[model samples]
Target chain A: MLELEIAHNWPGFQLQLHLTIGAELIVLFGRSGAGKSLTLRAVAGLFHPASGRIILNGRVLLDTRSGINVPPQARRVGYVPQGYALFPHLTVFENVAYGLRSSSKEVHHRVMEWLDRVGLADLAGRRPHQLSGGQQQRVALARALAIQPDVLLLDEPLSALDAPTRSELQALIRTLQRQLNIPVLFVTHQLAEAVLLADRIAVLEGGRLLQVGLPKDVLHRPARPEVAHLVGVRNLLRGQVRGISPEGLRVWIGEREIRAHWDPAAPPPPAGADLLVCIRAERIALVRPDRLPPPERENLMEGEIIRESDYGLSQVLLFRVYGPRLTPERDYDLEIEIPPYVYERLGLDRIRRWTIAIRPESVHGIPCG
Target chain B: MDWFPLLLSAQVATLATAINLLLGIAVGWLLARRSFPIRDLVGALVTIPLVLPPTVLGYYLLVALGRTSPIGQALEALGVPLVFTWRGAVVAAAVSSLPLMIQSCRAAFEGVDPELEQVARTLGRSEWEVFWTITLPLAWRGILAGMILSFARALGDFGATLMVAGNIPGRTQTLAIAVYDAVQANDPTRAGILVALLSIFGILTLVAAQQLGRRLAA
Candidate 1:
């Protein structure tokens, strides 16, 4: 386990983060300038905070109160900085062997073993520039792990790779983490990457962690409205609870009473409690008149296509309900995203009036307080 | 024509360049990586030798290390006095050309990405190890350029060398002083030869420095 409690102050920004990571991967997810990189640097001992205590396994890496600040060289942590600052002058084999301390034969064996593990054994003789971006990233990972560090910290390591290579490396990382069984903190701003790789997601914005939970929970059930927006929950409507039953809870969104899914495992909120209904745009499905209407429990509403746009792979359609508005002040109620193929198959361009349905499971409710 | 002065100038420039490499790298790295109360002041002092007249620089060196000065007296007791000797010529040349070496070294060290050093440190290498393994290799081209420039400048140094080493016939007379001596004795043939040699050597070093600088930027 790795524990971090850091408070750093800058001229215009301040970062105060406290998190404990176990043997699983805990992704530090945030936007730019959200202090994700700084947090990783602090863990790596590259950035010193004003006050903090860092412990990995059973060792105290930093304790400001006791003034026991171990330097990065002795911290026993693997750090792969963004852009993989590999030794440009050294070959791949030498880069991996840099931190190993043993006899010459042992060093060579260890370096080659790591290179083989990363699938870069063939390129060991080549310099960093001779290899592609993905290959360099692998070399960097190998070099960091070669030290047998107690914890691993990666800062946007795969952001520069292509899609196929990224997914390949993601699998490689997962395998490595499981094999090592060490605390791994992966930093990224991409939600898809975070959801795919993280055992738990930690959301941060403006140098503050808004929420931390499982990917599914943070996605479908964000703790705060800001986190909902960050996780791509485009339709957040203000609502108040009207009633509760064994089936589900009823909430008033605008002038309409909509039934949203509340976690049955937890104590349900009382009636008249304010809530912010989180509805993912992709979850809102466009109902085709040619097919049978969806059951009433899955919210069925009549809305018109207020606007539509094409973004090559996907299309965004701004929808406005006809009867009562979900957001009365805005011109549009919900923004829906569908693939171009679906848009064409549905003949949505020619048709403006459409019925939309949202699953109860998709309509998540968070108490607004 | 005798070649004693030519051989002496080459020996002095080579020795001075070797000495400048160490001092230059130390001061240059310090200036590039460290900040202190008198950082700018120290930087200005390092550069002052370049902007000052060589004769004025030589006068200061003479006062600071001559037989009358404390350092010179200490060296005398140690039996290595520098007054009016070939070794004094080396000192004069080294001092005169140190600025070029330091400027090159400072720029080289600055050009190196600090991220590389930070990464190396995390990999269990000490600060000293990181400097030798990472920083030195990356900044070598710049330092080499500086050394070549320093050699050229030291080889051709006249005003400072003449002041401190005093242009003795066979001991302290370097190529530049030889050229002056030949001209004073109305021997244009010898003066022309030495002058041509110095000019060609200077041009070659400048060209080499320019090439290295371009490659460093690339």
Candidate 2:
């Protein structure tokens, strides 16, 4: 287990992080320069936090208050920095064996085992410069793992590889993480990569951790608009609470009233309370214009496709409502996604006018306060 | 040609080159790894013997070891003489060539990546082991080149040797002095032979230095 509560002052930013990660793949997901990498560095003992404590496996790695700090080498944390940072002068085998100089013959056997595990045993004699970028990355991973660290930290390990190589390496990393059962803190900006590799994801912005939970929960129920945006939620509408019902709460967005599956744990939004309703682009269903309105239900709008972009597997469509923009007090834009097959079935490219239906459970509401 | 003086000159030049190569490596390593007040000033001082007229260095050595100075008196009390001796000539050559070795070794050491050293330390190698196994091997080429350059410089030292260790045939005379003596005696034939031998030695050292540099770059 790794528990950290750190507060540090950067040049123009302040970082305050509180997190507990068990022996699982916990991805620190955020946009560029959002302090995810800095957090990893701090945990690895490469960067000293100004205050607070870090404990790994019940051992105090850092405690600014108690004046205890472990140097990076002694912390026994394996850090695979971005771009691998492999020693260009050393051959792959030598690189992997570097951290094993003090060990006996058994350690040499372990090094070879790791090299074979990474599928680079045959390339051990080749220098780093002779290997492809992906191969170099594996060599770096093997070298880090040869030390058998307590925690493994990877900073955008896949960002340097090509797409196909990245996918393969990602699968390899997932397998390794499971086999080792070590607390791995993987940092990356790619949301899809985080969803695929992480058992739980922590979303960060502006040096703050906005939310940490299972990947599905963080994606389906972001705590803030910024978190929603960072996780690729596309439709955020400003609205006001109209009324509360036994089933759920009703919010008024523009001229349309919408129902949201109310989260009981959240503070009740007083009537007329301003709020933001978020919905994923893929959740907004497009219906034929001739379909009659469902009885007594809310959350329906007629809009025209103003722009569209093809993304191979899916097409993103931006819509402008026929009526005036959601009031000057509550401006909002709607977006929808349709898979390529769905687009062909709906003939969405030929029709500009359509009705978009947002299901209540699919729409999440957060009080603007 | 006086065969005795010629042989003595060759022996002194060879010994001086060998001594300078070892001293250069030691001093270069120190300069590369340690920092002290006036380090840059000391670095400049090392190279002063290279640029200053050889006669000036020779004159300074003469005063410092002329039996009147404390160092010279102490040596004399031990029944060892530096003045007008073959050892004095070797000392002068080593001093003249010291800068060349330091410069080469410094450049070589500077080329090694600091990250490699850090990695070694983290991998359980002590600082000394890292220097020997990783740092030295990587910079060996540059060190070799520097040693050779210093050797070549020491082989050609003339003015300093002449001033401190006078022109004692078969004892203090080096190749350069032998050639100069031959010229003063108006024997162009002997002078020509000694000058040719000096030229050959200079050319061989230059070629060796260039080849080693190219091999390292490759």
Candidate 3:
């Protein structure tokens, strides 16, 4: 287990992060300058926190109260910085052997074993510049693991690779994490990458952790509207709670009513209490106008296509509601995502008027207060 | 040409180059990696010998290391002497070439990415291990070029060595001093040979420095 409670003041920013990571892959997901890298630096003992304690496997690596701050070299924690940062002048074998210089002959064998594990054994004699980016990353990983550190910190290790290589290395990292059974703190801003690799994702913005949970929990149930936005929730509508039923709660958004999944853990809101209902774009379904009359649930709405775009694999459709009272005057805008296959089958490109339905379970409501 | 002065000059230049290379690496690494009070002042001081007239530098060294000065007295107490000696000539050449070594070395060390050092540190390497296994190896080409430049500079040193060590035959005289003495004595043929050799040495050192730099960059 790795625990860090640090509060440091930078030039124009303050970092107060408290987090505990177990033996699973915990990804620190954030945009650029969100302090994810800084947090990793603090754990590596490269950046000293003005006040905090860092504990790794019960060893206090840093504690201002006790005046015990281990140097980066003595921290026993391996850090693979962004770009892999392999020693450019050293060959792969020497780089891997670097950490094992102090170890016994048995440990030297282990270093070679790790190089083989990372699939860079054949390239061990080559310098870092001679190896591809992916190969360099593997060498870096081998070197870091040679010391048998308790915690492995990776800062955007795959960010520099191409898409195919990134995926390959991501799989390798997952396999290595399971094989090592050591707690790994992976940092990345790519939401898809975080979702694919993280056992638990910590969403950070402006130096604060907005939420931390399993990927499904965090994606399906964000703690805040900002988190929902950051997580790529395409539709977030401000509304007022009308009433609660045995099924779920009803919210009045603009002149329309919507039903959202209710969390029993949340405090009950009054009838007029404002709330935010969030639903991911991919969770929304688009129906032909001739399918049938709208459902009785508050989620069904009639809108006209305002904008549409297609990526190679997916399509995004932006819609604006039509009518005298429910015109585009309202602040809420709805976006829907469709797979390429669905886009072709529905003939969505040939029509402009459609009914959008958000499943009740897909809509998550958080009290604005 | 008589070979005595030529051989002595080569010996002094080689010794001075070797000493300058060692000291240059040490001082350059320190200046690049460390910060302290008057660091800039000390850096400027290291280059002062390069800018000062060689005669002025030689005169100061003579006064500082004369038999009466504290350093000279201490050396004398240990039964060692540096006054008007070949060693004194070497000392003057090394001082004159110090800036060349330091400048090249500082640029080389600064070109190394600190991130690489950080990676080494995280890999359980000690500070010294990182320097030797990573920093020094990476900067080896630059350091070599710096050594060659300093050696070439030392070979061409004249006024400083002439003042401190005095132009003694087969002893303290170097290539530059030999050429100066040949010119003074109206021995134009010997002087031309010595000057031609000095020019060839300088050009070869420069070409070697360029090639080493290119190899390292590649």
Candidate 4:
């Protein structure tokens, strides 16, 4: 377990992050300059914070109030910085041997063992420059793990690799973390990468942690508008709860009232409360105009196609919801995405007008940040 | 021609380069990695010898280390009077060549990625270990070129060595001063030999620098 509460003041940005990471992989997910890397560096003792306390596996690494701060050399934390930063002059064997300072033979054996574990034992004689990018990254990981740290910190380590190599190292990291059973804090801006590797996701924006939860929870039920946007929610509509009935909660989007679900796991808000609804583009389905009408519990809106685009595997359609009343506050232009097969099966490419059906449970209400 | 002056000049250059190697790397690393209130001032001071006329620098050293000055008196009491001695020539050469050493070293150290050092620290190596095992090995090629440049500069120093060491024959007369003396004595042949040797030394040092740089780059 690792607990970090740090407030750092840079020239133009201030980072105030409070997070507790369990022994699972916790990915610090955010855009560039979102303070994810800064948080990792602070935990590694490379960046000093103005105030905070950091505890790693019951060890107090830093406590500003008590003036207790451990240097990076004493922190005993494994850090794989961006670019791998392998010592260009050292061979892979020597690079891995850097952290092992005991008996020479024992160190050599351990270094070779780690090299073999990372599938670089044969290339231990080669320098970092002689290896491919993925090989160098594995060597860096081997060197960091040779120290046997209690916490592992990785800063976009796979961002520079090709797709195949990136996924290969991703699996290697998962296996290593599972075998070690140590808390790993990985940083990345790629949403797909985070979803694939993160046991829990912590969303950082503007130097603060906006939300932290399982990948499914954060993706389907983001707590804030910014997080909803970061997590790839394209259709965020401002709505007010009109009433709660046996069917579901009714929300007013523009002039049209739509039925949305209030998750039973979450506390129900009062009626007439203002909230923002997040519906992922993929969740909204398109129905042909001539098809049989669906149940009234589902949100059915008639809209004209304003824009459409194809991204190989799926087609994105932009639609404007049509209503009799025109309210300046209502932006009913909804963005919907359907897989290529769905696009072909529904003959979506043949029409300009269609009805989009949004399930009540799919429309998630996120309180404004 | 007596070979003693040439040998003495080589010896002085070697010793001066050695001293500059240590002083330059220390000051250069400090300047490259740290920011203090007087950092710019210290940088300018280190660069003074590079821009100052060699004769002016020699005069400044003479004034500071002359017999009547307090520092000179202290050194004399310590049995290390510097004026009119071969050691004075070495001191003159080192002062003149220090800026080259320091500038090259600073650039080299700055070129090194600090992230590498940070990673080394997180790997449980102390600052000293990181410097030796990571920083020095990575930057040594540039540092070597700097040392060679400083040695060549020291070898060719004339005005400063002539003033402080007084151009004594076979004792304090380095190759540069010997060439000047040969020119004054109307001995073009002797001057030609000494000048050719200095030029060849400079060319060879430059060649070595380029080769080392290429090898390290590869």
Candidate 5:
């Protein structure tokens, strides 16, 4: 387990955070300059914050009030910085052997063991520049893990690889992470990678953490407007609350009432509170002309596809609703996404007018100023 | 065919290079890795010798280590006086050659990626270990080149050695001073021999440094 609370005042960004990680992979997801890498460095003891307390497995690594700050050498945390930062002069075998403090015999054994673990045993004699980027990344991973550190911190490790190699390493990382019971913190800006690797996703923006929850929850129900945008929430509409109950919130959006999910743990918003309604592009489904309406309470609206972009496997369509339009000034109200096969099967190219259903559970709302 | 001056020059240049090898690397690494309030001032001070006239630098050294000075008196009491002595020539040569040595070492150390050293530290190596294992190995070629530059500079130094060590043929007179002595005495053969040797040696060191620098770049 790794727990850290850090507060730092920098020129443009102020870092304030309190987080705990158990024996699981937690992905720190954010946009560029959102402090994801900085947070990982802080945990690795490479970056120092003005005030913070970092505790790993009951051992205090940093406590500002008590003035206890451990040097990185003794912290025993594995850190693979962005680009791997592998020593250019060292061979792959030597790089992995670097962190091991055992006798020569034991070091050689452990080094070769980790090399095999990362599937690089045969490339041990090769230098970093001689190998591919993915191969170098594996060497970096083996080097960090060979130390048997209590925690592992990876910063954008796979961001520089080809798609095939990236997915290959992603599976390798997930499998390897499961074998080690230490807290692992991974940082990435790509949401798909985060969803694939993380057991929990922590959304961060502008030096602050917006929310932390399971991948599905963070993707479907972001807690803030910035997070909604970062996680690619397709439609964010200005709305006013009409009513609230155990059922959900009935919010008015541009001359129409749309139902949105409301958490029961918090007090319900007043009937007239302003809100930002978040609906995902993938959650809005097209209704075939021959089929009946979607299940109960799922919003039904008539909209015509205005513009479309073909993304090979998935197709995105701009949807503009009929009478009492959501946005009268614009040509589109909501953006919807469906696979290409579905588009052809539904004959969406031939039929521009369509009915779309938005399940109330998929539409989330955040209180607005 | 007097060999004393030749031998003395070799000893003085060799000893000066040794001192510079140690002092240059330390200062170079510090200058490259650290940022302090007086950083620019310190950098300028070290490079001043490269631009200053040798005679002017010799004048400062003479006063700083003259018999009337505290350091000179302290050394005198310790039975190793420097004024008009061979040791004074070593000091003069070292002062003049130091800047080249420092610049070479500074550039070499600065060329090394700091992230390599940081990663070494995170790998459980102490700062001292990292310097030996990572920094020194990576920077040795440049440092060796600097040492050679300093040795050549020290070997050819004439104005500063004359200003401080003075011309005493059997004692402090070095190769450069002896050449001057030969010319003053109208001994063309002696001056020609000494000049040929010094010029050849200076050319060889420069060539060797060029080759080493090329290899370092590659």
Candidate 6:
């Protein structure tokens, strides 16, 4: 297990993170300059955090209050920085054996073992410049693992590879992490990569960790509108809580009323309090206007299809309330997504209007912050 | 033509190059990897030899190491006299050639990616190990070229060496000083031979430096 809570101030970006990781793969997902790489560097002891404690496997790597900061060499964390940082002068075998200098007798054996594990044993004699990008990545991983660290930190290792090679290495990294059972902290801005490899994902923005949870929870139930936007949810509507009950809250978006669920453990906002409602584009089901309206009191919106876009496997439809005044602050437009098959079967291209069914359970209420 | 100056020049240049090699690398690494309030001032001080007239530098050294000075008195008490001797030639040559050595070495050290050192540390290697195994190897090409340049520069140094060591036959007279003395004595043959040798050596070192620099860049 690895736990870190650090706050560092930079010129343009401040890094404020509080996180914990188990033996599973956890991805730090964020945009450029979001402090993902900085966080990884801090944990690896390359960058110092102003205040916080980092504990790895019950060892205190850093504690600012006690003025204890372990050097990078003593931290025992394997860090594969971006670009692999392979020694250009060293061969693959020597690179992997670099950290094994203490165990001189078994250095070669251990290095070969790791190279074989990464399926690069034959290329160990080649220098880093002679290998392809993916091959170099494998060599870097082999070198990092040779130290037998308690945790592995990878920084955008796949960002430099081609699409096919990236996916291949992504799967390889995931399999290696599980087989080794070492806590791994992977950093990337690509959400798809995070979703594919991470058992849990931590979302960051502007140097702050916005949310951290299982892939499904963070994707479907973001804690804020910004988190929802980053995770690709497009139908975020500003609303006010008109009524509250033990079951859910009734929110008013313009002239429409939508029911949203709030975690019961946390006290729900009082009635008439401002809030934000997040409905995923895919979750807003499209129902024919002539069909029977969803049971009474359910969340529904009747809107005209203003635009449509084809995205190969799926299609997106932009729907706006039929008779509402469109203003910069209160435009009641919701983006809905449907499969290409549904779009073709329903002849959505020819349809001018859509009745989107916003399921009560799908409408997530986020605090208006 | 007396051949003794040739041997003395070779010895002085060799010793000076060795001394410059150590001091150059130390100072170069310090400049490349550290930042302090006086860093710019220290850098300028190291580079003063590149721009200062050789005789002016020798004048300062002469004043500082004169018989009445504390350092010269201590050395004289220890039976090691520097003024008007071959050892003074070594000091003069080394000081005049130090800037070239340091510039090349500093550039080489700066060319090494810092990330490599960081990764080495994460791999459990101490700073010293990282320097020996990674930094020194990667920067060797530039350092080798720098050492050769310093050697060539020391071999041809005339003004500073003449000021401190004086033109003494079979002892302090380096190749450059010998050429001057031979010309003054109206012996064109001796001056031509000495000048030709220095020229050939200078060309060879320049070629080697260019080749090594190209390889380092590649």
The CA-based lDDT of model 5 is what? 0.91
DockQ of predictions, in order shown: 0.80, 0.28, 0.71, 0.90, 0.66, 0.87
lDDT values for all models:
0.92, 0.83, 0.86, 0.90, 0.91, 0.89
lDDT of 4 by residue, A146-222 (tens): 99998999999899999999999999999999999999999999999999999999999999999999999889889
Determine which window of 10 residues in candidate 1 chain A has minimal summed lDDT. Answer: A289-298
Measured over the true interface residues after superposition, the C-alpha RMSD of each candidate is 0.5, 2.7, 1.0, 0.6, 1.1, 0.6
Write down the TM-score of every candidate.
0.95, 0.81, 0.94, 0.96, 0.96, 0.95
lDDT for position B63 in model 4 = 92
Which is better, 1 or 3, measured by DockQ?
1
- lDDT string for model 2 (A312-347, tens) is 999998877667565434223677888999889988
lDDT of 3 at B130: 84
A63-107 per-residue lDDT for model 3 (tens digits) = 999899999988888899998888776778878887775546776
CA shift of B143, model 5, Å: 1.6
Best by DockQ: 4
What TM value does model 5 have? 0.96
Span of ten consecutive residues with least summed lDDT in model 2 chain A: A324-333
Candidate 4: tens digits of C-alpha lDDT, residues B1-218: 78887899999999999999999999999999889999999999999999899999999999999898999999899999999999999999999999999998998899899999999999999999999999998889889989999999999999888888888897798999999999999999999999999999999998998897777667
Q: Model 1 over residues B14-50: C-alpha lDDT tens digits?
A: 9999999999999999999998999899889988889
Off by over 4 Å in 2: A5-16, A31-41, A44-52, A87-90, A101-104, A203-211, A217-220, A223-229, A233-262, A269-278, A289-298, A327-332, A361-369, B1-103, B157-218
Model 1 chain B is weakest, by summed lDDT over 10 consecutive residues, at: B75-84
Q: In TM-score terms, which candidate is top?
A: 4
Backbone Cα, N, C clashes tallied per candidate: 0, 0, 0, 0, 0, 0
DockQ of 4: 0.90
Q: Give the least accurate 10-residue stretch of model 5 chain B, judged by summed lDDT.
A: B113-122
lDDT of 5 at A342: 93
Candidate 3 chain B: minimum summed lDDT over ten consecutive residues — where? B1-10
lDDT (tens digit, per residue) of candidate 5 on B67-161? 99999999999999887899999999998999999999999999888878877877888989889888898898999999999999999999899
